[model samples]
Target: MKYVNEAYDFVNHAWSKGKIKKLIAPLEGLAYCTTVKGFKEVGLGVQPEESNYFNFFYPKGRFHDSLYGDDFPAEDLVSDCICEAVKQYIEGANSEFQVPFVRILIDLMSNPRFTYLRDGETEKKYVHVIPDDDNAYLLALRGEFLAKFHFGNKSDADDEYRAEFTSEEIDEMRKMSDLAIDWSKVNYESA
Candidate 1:
């Protein structure tokens, strides 16, 4: 499928309508993406000349430098939390592929408990990542969940961070692509 267009549509829909949702950009093939994020807006910028590439931007504001430093807030996401099932597929991905895949992540606050999940042993430890109002229970760490999910380690060590998931993890992740972006009514390309 046209995963590139799917990735673009996912972020575009999020900005246009402000309908917060969960989007998991796949890393199976060589993907071309700017970056990805969750919860917040990624500033504003003009579209790129290349139809294969897209970069969204947020307005200049308080968190401009940190969040909007790039055309869009570059989360450097690998998309789809790595389930324990398939942790080998992405083992050699970095050396083999350099495509930029992505996913949005936010540390869901735990005070209210309503927005957070605190039921199981595993669920209670990490910060709950609902991703949207739908309450899709994706767990995140108080620190960098992406690093933990991607590399199986939260440390910033280059080798550790670049570590890949098992083959089963990669297969499961491929099937787990979920970017609910609908451009049914809008002329997305022109807009």
Candidate 2:
């Protein structure tokens, strides 16, 4: 349970700082130790003097000692468990939401005549806003983007999808898109 708590804290710290890359080494090490050959390679081989009361007749080997020894930090054990959980969460979010949302945004951005329909009806559609519309266009785009992305489904359900992305990530996406649009506008005007 102590190891589990430590693992939870480690994951939270890494996630908060957007340092998901830090989990890679532990994940790789866990992967490497899954096979018998890998276990033998990584494991601290046979120890002769180590004997538990239950196994007094038969002393523990190097592999057993390596696992139970004080030298093996609790961090390593919990890291493997936490890293697997994080990996699964990322995969699920990517497949279920992120990829689809990005694809929909890209498709919409490429089409000049694209309109976001609040309902499936023409009367409820939101067409591209004019330059004089102030923030109306951005609001429309956000609504349409969220609608098309089906983000409402997850947003209504305790916002589990929001945990998959950091605020910086969302901001970066907006910044990049704005920069690209500004560049395009300047080039179009010059030409």
Off by over 4 Å in 1: 1-38, 45-68, 72-191
- Give the C-alpha miss distance for residue 113 in model 2, angstroms: 67
Instruction: For candidate 1, give the lDDT of residue 23.
Output: 23
Local distance difference test scores for all models: 0.25, 0.30
lDDT per residue as tens, model 1, 29-70: 212244222222322222222322322322221112222223
Off by over 4 Å in 2: 1-5, 10-17, 25-33, 38-47, 50-63, 66-191
lDDT per residue (tens digit) for residues 157-186 in model 2: 333221122234334544653323332221
